[model samples]
Every structure is written in structure tokens, then in C-alpha cells.
Target: MEKSPTTHVEYDSSNAHSNGGDAITRVPTQGKDAVVGTVRLLLGNETVLLPTPSPDPKDPLNLPAWRKWSILILISVFGCSCVILASGLGPIFSVIRADYPGQELKANDLMVYPTLFMGIGNVLAMPITAVIGRRPIILLSMVTLVVSSIWCQHSGSLGSHIAGRNVMALAAGQSEALLPMMIQEIFFLHERGRKLAWFVFLENFLVGIFFFTSNYMVSAWGWRGWYAFFAAFNGLILLFSIFLLLETLFIRPDDASTGQVHLTLNDVGKVDEEGANELVFRVTTKDKDFLEPEKYGVRTWRTDLRLWRKIDNWAQVSYFYLDFLKGIVHPIFFWLLLLNGAYLGLYIYQASTFATILMSPPFSFKFNSLGYVQGAQILCCLVFLPLLGYAGDHLIRFLSKRNGGVYKPEYRLPSLALPAIAGVIGAFMYGQTAAHPEKYHWLGVALNYNIIFFAFLGANQVALTYAVDSFPLKAGPLLVVVCAGRGFISFGIGYAVLPSIQAIGYDGSMNVVGTICAVLAVAAIPMYYFGPTFRKLGQNYYGFGASKEHANGGSGH
Candidate 1:
């Protein structure tokens, strides 16, 4: 028989906690009252905090809001800087090619190899981060970025330059995994969408702004100057990281006591009630903070800068590996990879080909003025950043409230609609403009560029945030799949774009590309509809822990 809403369970509290660190299961019982007890919400608290913070002041989740934001701001800026180094070369390829005269280096090689290596690097580095800690790996990557920048600046041949860029790209790749995990570890479930937006903005908007500004840098001091700038900037970030970045890998010993809950009602027995054959009651739990703050000593600045901490959970890594395997077959993972990959592929295709199209034949855009074309991207980013970041949070809060205070990850899916529409328009328009340059003005492609960037940035934020929200504990493995998948997917697209352009012409190619991406985007509708069922299928196996039944409870009221 299906358990009624009033189903109740009883357990021996002393026996349940006799062996510390194990969760107490509340078995359902038949009771007459329809009362359901849930995890204790702080009295009068409207929203339940997720992955509940411990009494320890040192827990990353317990840090002051200002401190958390400062760390996020610093890391995000450095991450965006790495992106600039990877992409800055896109607009200045001619200058780079000239340095290696008589070599058969193509623009696609410059674009493809680095992007491929970034993904490879991200996959390879994730397990190490899981075993070690985010601070050391992040700092190490920053140092490597600085060194690689110098190598690119001084390289004498095309091979050496490509090699340097690939190395730097490898360092940049770690951010894809680190950023989201760090945000998740430190911020509340309610705050993740907005915080992750910082990453998307830096990755998309700020990087787009760089495409415009980099041409001027190359014009004044040549291509080498661009590498020189990264070397200096990355060096500065490395110093700051050493002093400021705290280790976020902390273990919670009492997992069962934390706030996160999974509500499953199963009838184990029956009890008599007044005027009723049996009484059915439901088990409920509440998450609460430590009653006394002084019980845990405050964290010191010295402790904050520690490079490593002991993590006792050996099975955690194995669980991550399992999640990684499961994520490979997960429907949500595939949907996000396809949606994000398509936009990323399109963005890279546009960047790699922008110069070639405008600098040739009828349009003949001047070398000095070519960078301004990317200004369209900057404009689009500025307009959409607030919408995706703040407005997104507003929408989530409203939806969560409407859903009887239970927050579902699906609430975030509607935001995908705006980007999907923009992506279709951008892809087709850009393709048509490139194919028929004689008929359309350059402004047509510029508008397309603007819209496409908006789509890419929007997709990036939604895909990553949704993945993390779906499986917070498995963020390391889940991100490994998405980030690594995104990298390699973009690589394939980058390699194929030029040939596709030549073989089918831009119109035929883009029409196909746009249709495919729009379809991927449209798939979000069904995903939004069926997301919980899909999450429910994998949540238990993928390790959402005690709250596995509450797959949709990744957000707050």
C-alpha cells in the first residue's frame, strides 16, 4: 500500500547513534494523523540552507559573505585572464603567421589544438584536485600560465608558439572544474546561480571585450606584446593566490546531522489511532546550526592560508569516479554538453574565421579597424550579464516559493529559452552574411556576432550551474564530464568549421548548424518537464546521499 501523508516512523535514538557517523533512517509506519515531520528548519526560517554548514567557523561554508565574494572575485578575474590569453590570438593570427614564414601553419591549427589541450588538461587535473586541494592546484596552474605566457612571447617558430599556447591553455583548463566547485563549496544553494554567473560573465563578456582591445595591443607592440601582457598579469595573480586563497576541501564527520534531507515514506508497520484501524505518520528531520558558536574556535588568518588539510574519506574519490562513469550515461549531462558545446563551437568558429571573412575581397575591413567588430560582443555581454545573473536569481526565488517552498533544479531551465532564440538568429545571420558578403552589409554580421556571444555566455552559465545543482556532492566528477566534453566538442567543431564552410558554403553549413543547436536548445523544454524524474533515476546511484530522494531540492525558498 502507498504510504499516506500522515505515515509515521519510530526509531531508537540511542541505538541509531551508538555507532557514530551513520545516518538514522526514519521508517514509515501506519498512523491516523496526516502530520509529516521534515528536517527541522530553523524556527521561522523560510528557506532551508543546503549541504548544511557545520558549527566550525573554519568550514568554507561558514566564512563571512564579504570574504567569500572577495575570493570569488579574485579567482574569477584570474580565470578570465587565462581565457584572454587563450583567445587573444584569434584576432591577431596574421601577425603570428608572418613570424613563421614558409611554414604551413593554418589558422585552424592555432584554434583547434589549444582548445583540445584545454579539455584534456581539465580531465587530467580533476582527480588530482579531488585528492589534493583546490588552493595548491589553482596556484600551480597560475604559475604555469605565467611561464607559458613567457614561452609564447619568445618562441621563434610556429611549432614553438603553438606549443606554448597549448601549455598555457592546459593551465587555463583547470578553471572550468575549479570555479564551480569552489562556488558550490563556499556559497549556499540559493546563491550558486548568481555566483556562477560571475564565471560566465568573465569567461564570455570580459573575454569578448578582450577580442576588441587586443587588436590595438597587437597594432602598437606586435603579437609578442600580447603574450608579454599575460605573463605579467598572470604573475600578479599568482602572488595574490598564494596569500589569499584558502583551502576549501573540508570533511564533515557527521553527515547525517546536516540539513540536507531525502524524504521517502515506506510502510514498515501499523499503529492504532482513535476511531481508526491504524495510525499512519511520516518521518521528518530538520537542519540546524550548532547551538553555541564558541564551541568551535574561530579561524585564524594563518590557518586560512594553509596549503593542505587531511581528508579522511578515501571512498570519496572512488565515489567521484563512480559519479563520473554514471554522468557519462546521464541524460542531463548529454543535454548540457550538446547545448553548451554547440554554442561554444559556434563562438570559436566565428572567432577563428572573423578575420578571414572581413579582411578579404568586397568587405576589405582595415587591419586597424578589425578589432572593433568584436565590440558588438562587448555590447551584448554588458546588456545580458545582469539579466542572466540577478534576474535569474529573482526568477528562481519566485518559482521556489510557488512550489510550496521546495526548490527544483528545473526552475533554472526556463532561462535557456532566451539564449536558444538568440543562437538560432545569430548562427543563420552570420552564415548568410559570410556567404553573401556582396549583398549584406558588415553590420549584419556584427549584429550576429553580438547575438551569438549572448547565447554562448547564457548557455555556459545555465549548463554548468544546472549540473552542479543537480548533483552537488558529485560536482568534481560531473564537471569532469561536462568540462572535458565541452573542450573536445569545441575542438572537433573548430577543426571542421573551415572545411564545412568551403564544402557547403556558409549558408548551407550555418543553416545546418543553427538547426542542430536550436534543436538542442529546444530539448530543454522536455528536460524542464521531465528533469525531476530524470534526476530521480540517477540521484541515489550518483550519491546525493541521504537526500537522494529529494533530487529537486537543490535550491531554496
Candidate 2:
């Protein structure tokens, strides 16, 4: 073995991995294709997270400055566009009703079918992704979306439109779940906030843009034209991205190009048992090799013979799955679920009710066509776009640095409280305006959309990102459950909104929404203040300690 000038441990290929005997350090392969930070060398194969300094000229890990940002914005925009389009059906419901004409149509059902398709699609897409691989799935899904868009252009009957949406939703979920994992690989933690900003910015903008598409096409060219436009746009995306968007699945560290740090491969490596766990004993080294798990003589603990028996590929997958499943009951996820449910409910209500709300007397906004009113609500949604997009992300970065470089998921919340209050105000204004139809017409258009979803747009980002940051490896399954809950809960809310308005009266309905939002706002306290404590209490895999403590036999694991 060779000695180094400083305290750094010496490395020799001969003695590097002795019998997989002592994997002493926690190798931070936190996610598949996810690169979070650096690794440290310790007592023969020991694992511990050693936060390194930001890229200096001499550091090998310094990312490519010029191209990284450019690639990030481009990727984020594409990802956001795909996501926003999934919800685009909201702004065009009247067109759908008129065109399709269901026997018993309801607002909630409208939201349910499309997002249901998205939910079902997401539920199925993961294994398909694992089996088929990311590239083929992406290209094929895009093709489905493109074909659906074209079919929608010709859709005169209601049934055909629903079919088209099903196809589109199925394909769209790929981009939503897959892109962020790819983004995390190329960027550093310090710049992650900015990467997320671009992602959210485009997401909010595209959602607004999808609504306005109906304004121009519905009355002038008819509903079919709307399909043609998006189909054509989707085609453009497919063609442009085919070569520009490289397959980001697997890239070896040694094979990487110059100027990029290749040392962080463990963070991005896909976990499997085949070769990664293969042990090579070091007989020549003089230093005491860390004892292999096999020596413990516990049947479950063995690094050689069954080398990594308890920590093989299945273990990795099972461990991550359990971690994600357990997150839902955690106070953070439970509270986040409440926020998400409220936001989605509000979003569905605003989107579906826009047609009625805009036309009420105060605004007296009689459109030459119904699409005009949807466009107006969409415009109002756009008003909060910039603020919602950047505020939380900006705050996350500031607080991250203030915490002496240790980033907590809770840091994503400083700007979150204000939006909750805004949601309450929006609901209150909308309800009272609807309740007093003749007197409060003017303010209703702006205020009635309390579910304009600005709070949702921000909160969803914060919650999901918090989950991802806290439980890096298990984030996939946690999000899967969260997304499933979001879709299911949204359906219930969508079904009830119109009826609630009818039964409760507009003012009463909004008052209910305001109260829910207020409670969620308050609930945010326990999560922010006691989140770390609870995380520690549970030995959860949803945070840094999760990997260390929850590797074997926890409640769910």
C-alpha cells in the first residue's frame, strides 16, 4: 500500500475490495441515475457522506459551466410542457361536452377520466420502463401522444375525444416521472434550485398556454382544430428531441468526457447484484482489512459465500419500495397529502367552474364563444405565474446556504405560507361573489379562482422535492404512492365541486375551501418544526439517516 501526504487514505487496486468483506462506508448510490454529491474514503470500505466544497478550478468534479445551464433549461422546458398538457383538458371541457355529449356528464368525471388515465398509466409505466428501458418507452410514448393529437383533430364524436385523451395521458406520464431523475444526474446540489426553477416556470406557463389554445381554436376553427395544433406541436417536439436528447440512462465514469467529474457514479449507477457486489479478497495488504459480514456468522449477514446476501439487488429494490411506502404515513407526507388534495380540488374546481364563474353578472363577460371565458380564467392563472414559479425555489437556496451548507427538505417552505393564505383569500372572494351574484360580479373573476392553483403549483413542487431530497433512494415509490393519491383524491374533489356549489351555494362552497386551506396552512407547522425529529424517530429511509438505519427489518422494510 502507498501512503498519501495528507490524512487521505491510500488506494491500491489490489487491496481495494477485499472479499466485499468490509464495505465500511455508506456508498451513496441514493438513486438510479441520480447524482447528489461526493463520496469519501474511510476505514477499509467504510461509507460516510462527506460534503465537498463547490467546484474549484483544480477539482475534478467541477461541472461544465456553459453547457450545463443551457442543457438544463432546455430539458426542464420539455419536461414541463409534457406535464402541463396532461391537465390541458380542463380549459376545453365545454368543447368536450358539446362535441362528445355524455349521457351523465359531470365536472369531476371530466377531470377523473383524463387524470385517471394518467394515474393508471403512471402505475403501469414504471415496470415497463424497467423492462423496456427509458429511450424506447419515451419515443414510443411520444408517438402515441402524437398520434392521439392527430386523432383528436378529427374527433367529432365525444367517445373519440376521450380515447384521444387516454392515449395522451398515458404517454405524458413518462416525461413527468423520468426527466427529473435525469436532471439530477447532470447538475450539482448548489444549482439544483435553479434547475427546478426552470422546470416549474415552464410547467406553470405551459398549463396557462394549454387553456388559451381553446380560445383561438374552439369557435373559430372548431374543437378539432385544437387537436391538430397540439398534435403538430407534439410532432415538432418528437422530431427535435430524437437526437438532441441523448439517452441518459447509463454513463460510465471512466468513459465520460473531460471537464465533468466522473467520481460520483455511485449516485447514478443503477443498483443490481450481478457485478457491483462481486468481491475480490486482498491477501497481500498489511493493514487489517475490515471484517466481512460473512464472519459475523449470522445467516442473514454475509459479504462472501452469499456475499451481500442480505444486501443484493432484490434487497435494494425491496428496501427502497418499503421506504417509499412508509413515507405516506409520516407526518410530512400526510400533511403534504392534505395540501395536495386541497390544491388539486381547487384546481379542478377553478378549471371546471371557470365557464360559469366568468359569465356571471359582475363580469357580465358574455363571450362570443364559451372558450373566451376559459381563456379569461386561464389569464388570471397566469398572473401568479412568475411569483409561484420562483419564490419557493429562491427561498430553498437561501435557507440551504444559511444552514451552513446542509440542505433539508424543510428549507423548501419559507415562501410556502404566503401562498396558503392567498388560496384562502381567493376562495373567500370567489364564494362571497358567487353568493351575492348581483353585487360582487367584478371581483369574482379574479378572486373566485382561489383554486387558481398557484398554491398547488408551489406546494406540489415543495412536497415532491422534499420527498426526493429526504428519501433519495426510496423517492421513486414514495412519489408513486403520492401521485396515485393525488389522482384518486382529485377525482373525488372534481366529482363533488359542482354539486357542492349547488348544494352549499357558491359562498358556502368557497367558505369550505377557505377553511380547508387555512387548516393545511396551520398543519405545515408540525412538519417544518418536527420533521427531522420524526424522521430520526422512525429510522426512515425518507431522509439521510434512512439509508443507514433502515437497511434491514424496519416496520415496512
Q: Worst 10-residue stretch by lDDT in candidate 1?
A: 13-22
Tens digits of lDDT, candidate 2, 163-233: 77778787776654555554544443434445665665555555555555556666677767766777777
- Against the hidden reference, what TM-scores do the models get? 0.84, 0.71
How many clashing pairs does model 1 include?
Answer: 21
Global lDDT of model 2: 0.52
Best by TM-score: 1
Model 1 ranges with Cα > 4 A deviation: 1-45, 104-107, 202-205, 253-258, 261-293, 311-318, 541-557
Error of 1 at 514 (Å): 0.9
Worst 10 residues of 2 by lDDT: 254-263
Candidate 1 per-residue lDDT over residues 1-557, each given as its tens digit: 24245432221112211111112222233232211111222223344555555445788877877888778877887778877777656678877777666664453476678888888877767666665677788888898999998998899777788888899889888877777778777876667777878666655566666777788889888888888987898888888878778877654322222333222234435333343333322112242333224645779988888776553344445655666677878898978877788888888888777787888878898876777887556677666768888788778777777655546777788888898798899899999999999999987676787788788888888888788766555567777788778888888988888788889998888898789899999899899888877776664455443222221122110
Alpha-carbon RMSD, each predicted model: 7.1, 11.4
